[model samples]
Target chain A: MLCGAGRDRDVLTQQLQRLGIVPVVVDAMSEPVAQEPCDLVFIDVDVGRHSPALGGGVDIPQDRPVLALIGSDVPSAVEWVIEQGACGYLVKPIRGTGILASLVIACHVFEERTTSTRTISELRHRLKARQLVCSAAIRIIDVFGIGEDEAFHVLKIGSMERRTTVEDLAAMIVSGELSVQALGSDVEARRLRV
Target chain B: MKSVVPIGILFSTQGPYGTVSRAMRDGAMLALEEVNADDRFDFRLEPHVQDPEGVPAAYLSCAQRLLREEGIKHVVGCYTSSSRKEIIPSFEKHDALLWYPSHYEGFETNDNVIYTGAAPNHHVLPLMDYVLRHVGRDIYCVGSNYVWAWENHRIVRELTQVSGGRILGERYLQVHDCDVDRIIDEILDRRPSFVLNMLIGESSYAFYRAFAEARRSHEALHDTVIGSCTLCEPELAEIGASACGGHLSSSVYFSTVETRVNQAFRDAYRRRFGERAVPCADAEASYNTVHLLARALTGTTPSEIEAVKRSLYGVAFAAPQGQVSVDSENNHSFLVPRLGVSRSDGTFDIVRESAEPVRPDPYLVWVDGTGVWASWNGRRRELTNRPRLRVIR
Candidate 1:
């Protein structure tokens, strides 16, 4: 499902097309993303950490498998998204067979029911997180007109420049307070041109 | 300058051995056609082919044939390490150049044989780094009783010992031998986390089936990992599709080993041979060897063996496996080691790799930083000191 919030739909189309995976744009909590019926979901999304008060907007449904595109060398960013609810995470811009591998891993992970937590609420929270991350990703993609990998880098570079943190920026995006328009030039351009 | 080089391909056509012979030949033929079609060699290189049908004696005979009837001075053939051992003397006797194309048991050395294949630097130690992480402890090494098995097992034993894994079991099958049921029984009993298979030909095919059929889970076997440098594109088809999956096969080339060099080689090969997949190092090395010989022949008179040898010794190229140069001292090459996991399509999905070629130390020694070659263990074999060459112009 294409995260409508930060999506370069054209590039998402091309990257997914290359891997033979096509994107369908929608809110993660809505129809298809909610039903968990997609053979697989290629989630080039942003995510937020968990907090008790104010109930951070999204939930993680443990039923579906999600492949997240992340930034390289930033272990914290990976940790944050994975914590939110990415079954399999790949650093961007995804090149070569990395996308295929992430898709495979995500499918296997969900099919195996191998996520660490067994609680239903935890599963719900994870799925909700996955959806918010998706929305933020769509926004990034729309503004950047780049692949999932570049959208991911935009979030990562924004976090670094904002001097706050990747998790916070990802959370801010997921919370619907920020848009892809905030991305810096360095973040917009990565391995491939934006 | 237009040139022609006679190279021999030693393969088996009958019984269980024909698969490798066919695949290696196919890979080479495709490469040759493309090389001949291109401007790279200025379309000047022409290759002469001979197939010995996997017979060592026949290989020697073919070398004699190429050297005598064909008037060929330099050659590439003999994929098996054992076959290479067999033909070394023929090269020495005839003063002809033999480019030994497969990663072999590294202990052998001959001035006439230029190995454009993996040394221990290319195969053994790189896998050792993997063993330390994934496998919990023991590594079982299985192979055929021959020079290749012995040399490889020795190094494997050392690496396992250093990694703190016991050499739980060491089993050997005679060449061209395949005793599946018995070998499987021993594997089940010992139940080492992983087995290092050095068995070549039909035996490897048999062992892979026997191991896969056994009811064992990956987690239970997670600590065990089989590392075989001997198994390449040729063995993949023989072992069948389902059997070799997820098992790591180390080599200088795998069909899926994506590099600028390998990709170009694969495309040229596929275009020339109808999109065929080549898994054998011997075939790829054979492909490179012909081009090397063609250059040398073009540069000088094709008639003399010594002149051809000099040209080869001094020659280097941007090879598909990377920029491999003949070690002037050892008649060897330092090429990169690439390792991959077997997939369903009889190719490997490259898992880990070295971006650049690792110079082959004919005897897998760790050379120092000063560009001075020294013993890895500091206990120099007679080979440690080759005939010292002096500048005498």
Candidate 2:
């Protein structure tokens, strides 16, 4: 927890202890804490913004889940926390009551957000790969004078023959590492072998 | 000379959920009358009543008119969560406080609204405990397709899973849809230990009557019982005599709570609305809402929403459901949870009750810990008996 020593921190620490969560409190002025080892990071938005230890601003690690401790609901304060990629927030003057809730909800929301982010990235990669496959298939069509389905079949056969993924073979064909002509010849050679 | 405070009263007295809403309105009216007569406060509450007729759209318009045209700062209304959700934006936009008085599936806290009802932890958690202890683990869920049903069922499912129990069957019917024969047939086929009835208003009444009839014919269903958190005394009357008794309900207040304050409240309610208008949990909460509002407005100006809200925090009332208070943190009430069984005469027999008011955990963060289920006094350990996996091959 990167927070200044105060009632909010004390109350939060006590509550966390009660919930069986061992909160390792790190003062904002202390040496930079290794965030990679931590499961969850709770940063005080107000303090972290001014703290030199946090590099004068809260640098929320992308891999770790963050929960913001906010003292003010002003748009700027909230916006700052949101920009920091905090999954959840606890309003300042933290009471013992909402700590568990904030923690649970924050973790759950963070997991969902992380999953969605990962899914989107994976989908984008696949989309690019699909474009490459399409480009390779079109090149095969242009070079060999075959139908679109037959071009895709030839690519599939070439990938199988090369012992590579269809996407990898498509990339290889698109990059001109394995030319479309070579792919067509490979498909023919594989058919003759069969 | 008493100052007249125009209080907005929004309820649907003529729709699918009208019976309970009528009772709620009556409860508010009763408290309004009491507050006006008491002379404890210098201001007299004048109710500017509007019936939305259970239409979701009408709630916003009615709430808007109340807050804008009527210039009412405090309103005690809303039976369904959807209606409450619809008008909340209007309340927030107008900077008015909506004194919502109905137990709902929680997970909400708004500065513009004071929830004077049982939160999920205060209602469903205790009910689940009772069901798992006395009733059966295999649950068959049937609810109206709405947020209230969905959220409550989610809690039930979570608790059931944590306890190593099973949800045998689940179904969601449209609001006010009474085509429950198919659901009943499915329940008969599954033969669940208990039916978790999340259906509201007319749909609930229809299910009760139909299920009762089905139970009479099916010997397998004789042991199976219907359980609900929304079932109240007025709804019990609607369910009719033969089907009403033996059903379990979890609530903050029941008309049959044998307390001096409750008895007096019941007597006054009967005197005001006559024998037909029964006081249920929502009615009691509505009654409590008005009283709380009156208390908050004792010396404060009605137009100042912030002052009224500030005054409302941590205010305790000798409510029909014991000493209920507003949680300073979450505007929800700290209410005593009670488990009751419906009687033939349209009242609940209190089976179990908390020793004191349980703090309202709207998000259920406290009741359910970081993990899906927290240790609840070793009850989870006692209840969980997982079947061991064996190699069939």
Candidate 3:
């Protein structure tokens, strides 16, 4: 937890200890402790804005969930916390009542966010791979003088023969690393071998 | 001279959900009269009643007119969450306070509104706990398609999942839609241990009647009971004699509670609105709201919204439901939760009740640790355990 040395930290640490979570309190001005293998990070938004390290462009690890300790509801203070990618927050004068709730919400929200982010990135990669496959198929259609389905079939055959993914073979074809004529030959060779 | 304060009363009283709203309005009116009659306070409340007729848009207009034109600062009304949400901005803009008096799916804390209703922790959580402990966990949910149903069902779904139970089926109908034969057929087909009914007003009454008819024919459905958090006395009467009994409802206030305070309340309500207008949870909350408002505005002007709100916080009233008080942090009431079984007389027989008023957790942040959050995190572990394999071979 990145917080200024004060009563808030003391209360938060005590409460966290009661919940069976060990509190590793870090000063706000210190560098982002990316080496620390922590499940969650609690950053004080009030102290975060004034920190030379956080304000001077330190990247808080996006993989771990961040929970903001918010005392003020002002837009700037809250917006800064949002920019830090806080998944949940606890209102200041850090009491024990809401700590478990905040932790639960933070973990739930963070898991959701991480899942969606992973899905989006996976979708983006698939889309790019799909475009490559399409481009490779189109190139095969032009070079081998075949229909779209037949061209895709030829690519599939070549991928199977080469023991590579269809996407990988498509990337190779699209990048002009392997000629469509060579892939057609490979397909013919495989069919003859079979 | 007693200072007169104009307070706005906004309720539908003539729409799909009119039965409950009428009772709520009467409850507020009764409290207003009591406040006016009581010599203990220095101020007398004059109620300016407006029936929004259950339309969401009308609530905004009615609330605007009350706050802007009539210059009323405090309004005791809104039974549906949609109506409350609709007019909240108007209250904020006009610097007025809305005393919402209905048990709702929580997760809101607007500065411009004082929620006298049972928050999810005060109603749904307690009810869910009771049902899971005593009854079986396999539930089929049917509700009106809205936020209240959606949020409450979400809680039920999460809680059920955490407890290693399954939701057999879930369905939703439009707010006023009463075609429940298909849902009844589905319920009969699924044969869940219990049906969680989140349908409101007419839709709810129709479902109860239709389900009762289905149960008469199908022996399997006889044990498949219907449970709801929004069920009340007036609604049971609407469902009629054939279907009214044997249903379960969780509420903060049921007219059948055996207490001296409740006995007086029921007698006065019967005398004023007659036996037809049976007091329910919403009515009791509205009664509490008005009394709290009157106490808060004893010496201060209602126009000072901040002072009135400040005074309103932590205000306690010996309400019909028991000693109800406002939580200073959330502006929601610390209400006692009760689980009741409906009888043929259109009143609930109290099955279980909290020993004291439970503090309102509007966000469910405190009470929901073992519910959605736990289930979500549990799912996370399951996801991690499943081996992520690639088609390398």
User: By summed lDDT, which 10 consecutive residues of candidate 3 chain A come out lowest?
Assistant: A50-59
Off by over 4 Å in 2: A1-194, B369-393
Which window of ten consecutive residues has the lowest lDDT sum in model 1 chain A?
A: A47-56
Give the alpha carbon lDDT tens digit for every residue of B41-131 in model 1. Answer: 6434445677777665576677777777776666666666546654665667677777766676565567777777777666766655555
Expressed as tens digits, the lDDT of each residue in B147-222 for candidate 2 is 6776677778878887888999878777778888899999989999879999998999999999888877777877
Q: Local error of candidate 1 at B331, Å?
A: 1.2
Per-residue CA lDDT of candidate 3, range A1-194, in tens?
87777656888999999989998976544566565679999887645654242142345778899998876443445566888899999976576788999999999999999999999998888787998999999988787676787777888888888998788999998888887788768556545654
**DockQ of all predictions against the true structure, Cα-based:** 0.00, 0.02, 0.02
Stretches of candidate 3 exceeding 4 Å from the true structure: A1-194, B275-277, B369-393
lDDT (0-100) at residue B48 of candidate 1?
69
Quote the lDDT for B172 in model 3: 79
Q: Flag the better candidate by lDDT, 1 or 3.
A: 3
- Per-prediction TM-score to the true structure, in the order listed: 0.58, 0.67, 0.67
- Ten contiguous residues with the weakest lDDT in model 2 chain A: A49-58
All-Cα superposition RMSD per candidate: 27.5, 18.2, 19.0
